[model samples]
Target chain A: MKGPRLTEIVAGLPAIVPFVGPETQERQRGRPFRARLGANENVFGPSPAAVEAMARAARDAWMYGDPECHDLRAAIASQHGVAPENVLVGEGIDGILGLAVRLVVAPGDPVVTSLGGYPTLNYHVAGHGGRLVQVPYRDDHEDPEALVAAAWEHGARLVYLANPDNPMGTWHDAATIGRMIAELPEDVLFLLDEAYVEFAPAGAVPAIDISDPRVLRLRTFSKAHGMAGARIGYALGAADVIAAFDRIRNHFGVSRIAQAGALAALGDRASLDRVVKEVAAARDAIARIARQNGLTPVPSATNFVAIDCGGDGDFARRVLAELIARDIFVRMPSVAPLDRCIRISCGRAEDLELLARALPDALAAARA
Target chain B: MKGPRLTEIVAGLPAIVPFVGPETQERQRGRPFRARLGANENVFGPSPAAVEAMARAARDAWMYGDPECHDLRAAIASQHGVAPENVLVGEGIDGILGLAVRLVVAPGDPVVTSLGGYPTLNYHVAGHGGRLVQVPYRDDHEDPEALVAAAWEHGARLVYLANPDNPMGTWHDAATIGRMIAELPEDVLFLLDEAYVEFAPAGAVPAIDISDPRVLRLRTFSKAHGMAGARIGYALGAADVIAAFDRIRNHFGVSRIAQAGALAALGDRASLDRVVKEVAAARDAIARIARQNGLTPVPSATNFVAIDCGGDGDFARRVLAELIARDIFVRMPSVAPLDRCIRISCGRAEDLELLARALPDALAAARA
Candidate 1:
């Protein structure tokens, strides 16, 4: 029988997964990692209140979640000092990115981003048949000027930048990003991914300007709120742009447990502050470990630190493999230059202790 | 400033939401409903084991869920006697349907469905710019022959049917549906939504045939498994067809709690059977109430029943409005003939008792 014919766009696209979860590796290795320090997940965990809310909501799982996500959006808006209409809650920033791309990008449209930035955004671009124009990083930081130049040159529909960038753990301060946004073509949408903003210093984040129709800022409970597994995130943008999400998004996509958990997570300021502090300490510990091993650690504003392996991408991969062999979970960037470093998420004390023990042996094995 | 330019397709698309959630109505009305039955959620609730699993997983919300959904898919496959590759887990049936439409329906592509069928599927097709060719339901049941005929007539890329249909709660036996499937065009992908299948009779569901490349059967934790708020569902299809989901789906869309909960729900057959029994009893009770109010209840295989209001669509609308004013949340079909009935989900005894009391007054209000 002739099967269903895939659309030209889908049929021509490569079967690519942006990131492989740590669980896949655990299954393949036939053992669990001693330290789960990959994926940049806040190992300090979600607020007690959030967990409590989720547990309580579980019994009510028989009801479909509010398709409008009214309360969650309202809470997010109030916190951000915006109207509820300005916020759109989704499964995560990843899901929201997909919808944003769908809203603006057509087949063959150009989308600009850092060369080795968040691959999930790139994956969404590819899925929608958008052409990517990648700007190489400058000194391990996403080059805002270069990205803006590319967006202008390509007449890009969407331009994405992760503040306090991933993998390299490098960031540009608010003024640089704000200037970049101003330089972009008026028609080009700027996606400001603040997934790590809560962990960054005050100067690192730009003040919210809801009046900018071309800019959409995405934040998530997945980071400092320590609720990555809950799969909830929100985008703050112009009301018109935010409302566009309802036109195409799966309305009931966000789970009821997630809505309740995120609302509670937002209300619990103590937990957020505590997780941020723990992450800061873990980052320092990771850097110290890197220095002891004769490696350089990138100054990070995010929860994860990138430790230069003092070698090339190949050598870093070897070190990563050796760490995996020793039941340590870690990751590295995929592009050149930055790929010389291995990225490790902030872990709990025991998790970092395991990493501390494994690093030297893994480095030795890689060198050998 | 021009701001971001939406794609021509998106710009041209209508701002249509498939369903207005009950939460939205509650907010507008300034009160909560006495009985929550509007969305066809299983009010008897999810399995206790499933709830327990979700609550336990709540603490682990720090980590991202498995993108491959290996364990859950393996379990689903094992139950259905198919390879793990044949099962694709997603956020929900609504989410999976969106991906399916994206895979097959390009701009201006034809899609076929019952006139008043699951509007969410229509929403997705519209979102993708697919041309919908809706065939009218015959005698309140989805006319399988007309749908198949429409596929042939329009050369449809996709065809959708909900077994034990929603809104009307009518169903076709396995043999009839199997024959309908056989008559479909070789290249037209068939989306058989058996969301409420657990409540269906023995012959209502066709035998699983995962080898069929064109048929993708959808099942959910939302109905008989009673985990609607968890937002987890699975699609069973040919391995190649199922694997195509990876090309465009939000890989991490499903929540970690939902995966664990659904896995536990699948394991707890006793709980599932018990829910089914309760649903059957509730269906009977709802039917008895309808009869007592001088209404004709449609024979239903799903967890909800559609009662003929003995009036036209306008009268049914008035009755629905009166019910809503009484703080009893219920919905009716949107298309004619079917719209002459009001749909009510099976609920707990107290919920039904409340509905029973409200019906006569609602009907009188409509009559007056």
Candidate 2:
């Protein structure tokens, strides 16, 4: 009755999920959320055109998707003014992160990232037996200097950074990032995650030449384009680095309906622009609400606002739990200093109103 | 500006795709196929109810799919009379194959499968640095005896077998397979892919005994339920084996629309029964047409028929090319002996008509 033993590394690993989805919590509570502002999902929704394209595609779901992802890749290449060979579309950035880790990391190879950064990437590195070297955040921002120094110290093959960072919603301007990129060791490949780039300020994202083989930039439709449920994302890199994906990727992993939906979503720039504007207004409203409640709202370059609890991590955790109990779903950071804040996403008017009403009572309960 | 070097194993790997989808071939020829019988897809199409479900879910594509795949897993578990912990929904059997390889295989690890078996599984094993030990088909069927011998000889950590097999459309009955399973080495895991099981004979599948944790059964909506483009599949195994998937799988990889479509497809047994009946008729039609063209069609347990070319691999390849040139899309096995046969999938009357008209000319050209 015994199963075959897993590989030594896999046996040592804990079966941990990076995030406990709200769905799981709802199932535990035996009820659905009245307001869902967690996970940074676009409650503003996808474009009407994209929805129509998906509906049209639904009837023809018998045939397998094009393994090459031809049309979608061509559209992405055109938008970026690059050759199609420079782009590799995957299930999502999360999927691509796994592939990237597989390509470069052998057992015990070193990888570097900010301590409180994207856990999914670190999960992939660990899955592949990579040794992770952590660098602590500085003043609520990813300390690029510390990350570069750690990479060099550990002889790390990979380093990950999110522009317009998550959890804290802070950012470093393009010039600052460019200077940090120059300091990265020649052998250390930079994985620049720009999941929130479309919502960042004009000068926040750098215009680095993608022909630099030392860097791979990841982008997703989940945030700005509002196709999170579609699971479409892409990586842009030098042609050689991008071509390596063909050596091991699940070529037919992206569904046909997803490709159709993402292509249509990309074409609807007006909808994207409108979402960006709405997100900005929502951020301002959230900040005002936080100030009225005597909480400090961190300066945000992304869709979500991180409200400083003006207390310790335990207080922030209690506030998050109280919000969940009130049927208002929100999240908080997982690590030390950053964990002292609660993150709220941009939601529809009704969802925001619910959050607004629930927060004061939730805060009071946490305080009590 | 060179990036970090890929591992020695990955650097030596060729850039090869396990299966070239029909869509890619159509793009290369700059014309669509008159009949898509190459990939064994269910040309009968998915249920209308499933299509409607997907269409309805399309508007809500802005929210990320529940990473837990809660509802679909619950439904599948209920259908199978098992707990939800025993089921893990994935992108497809292809995606699950990759995860299995990651969990069990390490560099230089031995893995066993039939020669010319599911190439995607082989691709994943090689991608993860496993040394593949292949056993040849016996009398046009996978020899479970040889597979077991090879596994023992090489101390293989895993072995893969497809029932109602692809390429050759052959199968071994439950008694024979159960005997093989009983004889298998205790530490060696068996991946029994039942992708086309619904189309198989009633007695072909063995009774489920999940107590034997060394066996993991994979099933898919891609074949019998006619949802290949939806990209939804599931794996059933012991709780420990199933739990391992959570440590590495892309949590939000399956799209919301796809999950909805697959769940609806699973619930519609009447549609599935009708499709099975239609598939049997189509298989018979394909065999009849092959006989009319002076070819010998292999007896099949699944949705496709393989016709022996009465010559070597070269003649079969020429015949396949001629079929493609005539806009009748078909495929053949990649290795020798089996390569002397061409595979054609079950399809509707109109699609079979295209095949019927094209086969004679292709055969004559091959003879010439």
DockQ of each: 0.83, 0.79
Q: Give lDDT tens digits, candidate 2, residues A1-368.
A: 66787998888777777668888889999999998899899988888988998888888889888888888889998998888888999988988999998888888999999988888888889888899998899999999889988988898889999998988899999998898888888876789999999999989988857778878989998898888888889998888889888889997888888888988988999999999999999999899889989999999999999999999999999999999999998998899999999999988778888988998999999999
Off by over 4 Å in 2: none
User: By summed lDDT, which 10 consecutive residues of candidate 1 chain A come out lowest?
Assistant: A12-21
Q: Report, for all candidates in order, the number of backbone clashes.
A: 0, 0
Query: Candidate 2 has which clashing residue pairs, if any?
Result: none
Which parts of model 1 have CA positions greater than 4 angstroms off? A16-18
Model 1 docking grade: high
Shift of residue B365 alpha carbon in model 2, Å:
1.0
Please give the lDDT score at residue A187 for candidate 2. Answer: 72
For each candidate, what TM-score against the reference? 0.99, 0.99
**Over the true interface residues, superposed, what is the Cα RMSD of model 1?**
1.2
